[model samples]
Target chain A: MTGGARRADPKPMDVDALIDDPGTKIVVCCGAGGVGKTTTAAALALRAAERGRRTVVITVDPARRLAQSMGLEELDNTPRPVPLPRPVTAGGGSRDGQAARVSGDGQDGQDGQGSLHAMMLDMKRTFDEVVREHADPERARQILANPFYQTLSTSFSGTQEYMAMEKLGQLRQSGEWDLIVVDTPPSRSALDFLDAPKRLGRFLDGRLIRFLGPAGSGTFRLLGAGMNMVGSVVGKIVGTRFLNDLRSFVAAFDTVFGGFQERAERTYRLLRAPGTAFVVVAVPDSDAMREASFFVKRLAEDAMPLAGLVVNRTHPLPTGPGADLSAEWASTAADTLADTHPLAVAALRSHAERVRRRERELWLLERMTSTHPDTRVTEVAARPEDVHDLVGLREIGSALAGDER
Target chain B: MTGKGGTGKTTAATALALALATGGGRVLLMEVEGRQGVASLLGSAPLPYEERVMLSAPGGGSVSVLAADAEAALLEYLEMFYGMRRAGQALTKLGAVDFATTIAPGLRDVLLTGKATEAVRRREGGRRSPGGPHQYDAVVMDAPPTGRIGRFLNVNSEVAGLARMGPIHEHAERAMSVIRSDQARVHFVTLLEEMPAQETRDGIAEVEALGLRPGAVLVNMVGPRLLEGVELTAAAIGELDEVALIDGLRVVGATDPTGLAADLAGEVRSYALRHLLELRVRGELEDVGRPLVELPRLEGGMDRAALTGLARRLSEQGVRK
Candidate 1:
């Protein structure tokens, strides 16, 4: 798909079949902000579970609506089972990932046999967990209590990306569910999720860090003899106390640094693996489509598995026997009809506006498709209300699967 | 000002800058995120740390823009506080500047705030040469998104790790005072949608929690309120007639009136939903207790001219005053 003569149009992404396939273990919903990415991930996960796949959704979006939609008061770092829609809410089954995987036997009147678990990525908490799990108590305490470490753990620039990758790897290794759906973090650039681990790893192993690592490790340290001069130069400028503190923090973090590189590499390989499919969600606006195309091009460059595009809140053109009325004609007519019929006048005005907007959206989408000719796209029309409940999600799911509008 | 991702805060901030500068007062519009949002919004080249003229407002004033880089901020800080250029250069060599700005997000925010609020508090020109002419009458920053607005502005928290006495700590505390003082107001920009409205409510609370008063809520991209209080509820239930609309379009010389009718019917449904959603969002902003400014959705997709129109609207709405 990345390198070839492209078809006139890409295949529509089949969400249900993708989930049902045992080979597809990881589904990453990534896109620009305000493009309904969180909603797409939640709906896809919900649909997957209902279709008899033991699915767990891990969303890094800071928005709390995912929990709200599932009727859970909140979701933290740990995965919480969302209550099923069945009337027998007091425990009609579905406890573990295993028992929840029920076969199809017509036992699905209201609720599906599959299970859905969700967790909000708490980056600091995940970092804390990683430190606690990786280091001995004394070492972990020393590292965590360091002022620099405290700042880095809580508000470091690439921390969210690194921790999200860490969490994804943790979930994959936990062997809990058959399929896992991951939502990209709220970072403006969707590629941040992909670039974070490596960036974090580099910072960990970078020149300053190596200069600050234990003096004893200098025998093998590649900075080679000028390290002390560089260190002293920094120490002289920042004051010896601050440099000493930073050095100590780096020394304490050295053990975790190598582990970080390893974990990042593992996750990077996992992302490039065959089982992973990236679903880029976007609204039909020009900026959104441009970002979506950027994402497509980046994923292609990285050789990540591209599973087509999911265009959300798309404005479909008016379709009937003959839906070819030009917006200019509608505008002229609306202007003429404005005096007597206010409601119809307003309606015509809106018709003209909608037609113009839909045309722009199609023009942009075509521009995107022209660049990547074989890119598959599924268009989901906008919902009047926010999808706050499972029914709304199911409607979205049906829309995603082409079963409903 | 800040709001949720994709809430058009950058555009609003630019317009606000233009509006504030319309009275012959120079305004500095700073963007800290390196998103180049202000540059694109103003149709200027990518802004460096140096202040450059972006636009001259219609009335009389001018707006200057700056993408406040952390490194340049730290250098500026050093030059102003310590009077040592060599030490700043040395630190930059050690990657400490990069580490402080990009590596430590909180510290980077402190630098961003320290620089911007410094400009805000400046008396036209340098305080040393007091009353000659002001650098800017006001400073408007296109801050981080609503989710991190609190953290970005919380200089006290950023200083908490620095043991109470260092220059960095002192700088943070001073920045905190300026930010929390009556001199500063953190405005919010949001859309008339559920997520953005909810985020705006929470964001206002967060700003207040940081001991800062919230500013106006600039609601962007608002569509026309064609359906009134009771009309929306009626429209949502499919009561708006499609056939009559089709006949009216035919009578008015529209080609293919049936398709236009279908489009109008669908549009009415969408508009009704938006109306209902917008009504609830208005209530949410009201609960935030800040004055609200409603900017209409631009007709031809908010080009530079339309952005100027929005600035004029904001000025009319008394946003600058």
Candidate 2:
């Protein structure tokens, strides 16, 4: 089959060794939708914490499964501590160690080597929080109060990405954890999170600046008259006070553009810094691989530090001489039943063919990864059950650590 | 509403348009994404916003294409709503208009839907005017993927919350009338796979919650032929004696001499049978209430020829019926 013959026996994974490696700051888990990215992120963080490194996992996925995995029914915009089993004391008695908590609320906790924290981002809430944190409280409140800002924060194309960075920055600057593991949204918008800060910064620094920045008195009067005339015409046509509201919102938020621009730049710089790393996640399917490749190229183009790739739900072929038994049995059955029972033979043949095809696909994936010498290629076996709790995550983490040769 | 990209939304929409148009109805194929994927699939150049390009199909049917360039469409929208001809000029001057229209999420969606509504209302022929084509018999939209489709189609709700009681609100109400009507429909295209199927379910629930009609579900890349009957059972095969089976095989035996030949042939046949069964199980696509149609997997990707073949297959699958 693919990857040469499989190992004689399945190897045990070294979760502790991988988690303790100081260079591994980012753990990106990407795959097609519903492939357990959220579970992977939580497990990675759990593994890190178990190794005595303070860890925080953040997810921007709208699904509540991430929170539920941490035993919380729901999460908010801020980071909360998740309750983990306290380490055993040297005396063989359990000490009342720090509580592990996971929160959706967008606040950072203090740095600790033995603790774990988790959070889910509320995109719009995080964006508003960023604005409120950077601008004068009154100005921020005014902007938040504006209907346009409300819509823009929630529905804007790059806003989720920008907000994700803002949330990451908060965690990074907090120094609350030794390592941060982020579970990005599914492949659909994950890349946007990487590109969002720069795009948003450009938007703020360019057109937004021109539209909302201070204008010369003479220019203001001329523009105001022009705006008024246009508004009157549009009012007649579409019959709305849209122009008037837009004007007021622009005028109110104009003064804060400089602050917004600065924060966006800071967030962008944080993402590009060496302290952070980008992990690309994908499944073995063609669609997922295409997105992963695009993301890898985009990361290179943007000069982002790509750590490696984490291919999830990879099918593990059975190993050794016994691996071909199913095929041999099918062929023998096929010949015996060729005339007496064509359908049974056909069914067996089909099953064997599917397994062989999957092997070929796996081989192609390995070939695709050959060009990236530096990027580590890791695969997680497809689990028989969905991962939903600490035990499941631990199993996933063990599989991810690779076979202990 | 399928989460998978390149599933065949454009092809289905195009086929539906052709079906309507050939049945003696005028059709408008609107594309929200600026990719011009639909036009390209139809072997025509990209169309501009507010302009119509006639597409004569090989089957003696015709369709029209309209591309909603977000920036230009937004400018047209501003002009139509606010008598702001200079607004477009102003946006161009600041170089913000293009970015605003294209990069702004939901803005493009609003403009595209607004334009569709406008097309629905634009009269084909006045009572006294003869010989003019009807305004439009059907509008087929190759919408965004399922992830944001709900928000994309329901732009009116967001806009209405902002622009209450004005002409904008009035227009939004009018657009809602068309969207909420049975005449307007949304179909999802997905592969009969796990993830895409799950997303389709979620997308349908979300779309229905937003008060939009979820029409047919098109399952693409269905498996080919399947082998059926008693031959599928193990007992029938076990009944054969080894010697008898070998002699029977020898009687019809073909020449074969190669290294690893037996294993390789078995592998190839095994693979073929697996796909057949996969295709068969995929045919049970009853997860959604909409009629399920199957599109066979083409050997090549969705190029022009592939798309035409897909359209023809879709017609043969009785999409109109």
What would the per-residue lDDT of candidate 1 be over residues A32-122, giving only the tens digit for each residue?
7888887888889888887776677888754565566664455468776665554223444443333342222223323435777777888
Q: Taking the tens digit of each residue's C-alpha lDDT, what string does model 2 give over B193-235? A: 5545656778888889999899878887665443434322222
- TM-score for chain B considered on its own, for each of the candidates: 0.93, 0.78
Instruction: Report model 2's interface C-alpha RMSD after superposition on the true interface residues.
Output: 7.1
Q: Residue A203, candidate 1: how far off, in angstroms? A: 2.1
Candidate 1 regions with alpha-carbon error over 4 angstroms: A1-11, A84-113, A213-247, B43-45, B75-94, B123-127, B242-247, B253-263
* Candidate that scores best on TM-score: 1
lDDT of 2 by residue, A279-360 (tens): 6766665545656676777777878877666777664434432244354554565667677744445544543544554565
- Pick the DockQ winner: 1
| Worst 10 contiguous positions by lDDT, candidate 1 chain A | A1-10
DockQ for all models = 0.38, 0.20
Q: TM-score of every model?
A: 0.89, 0.74
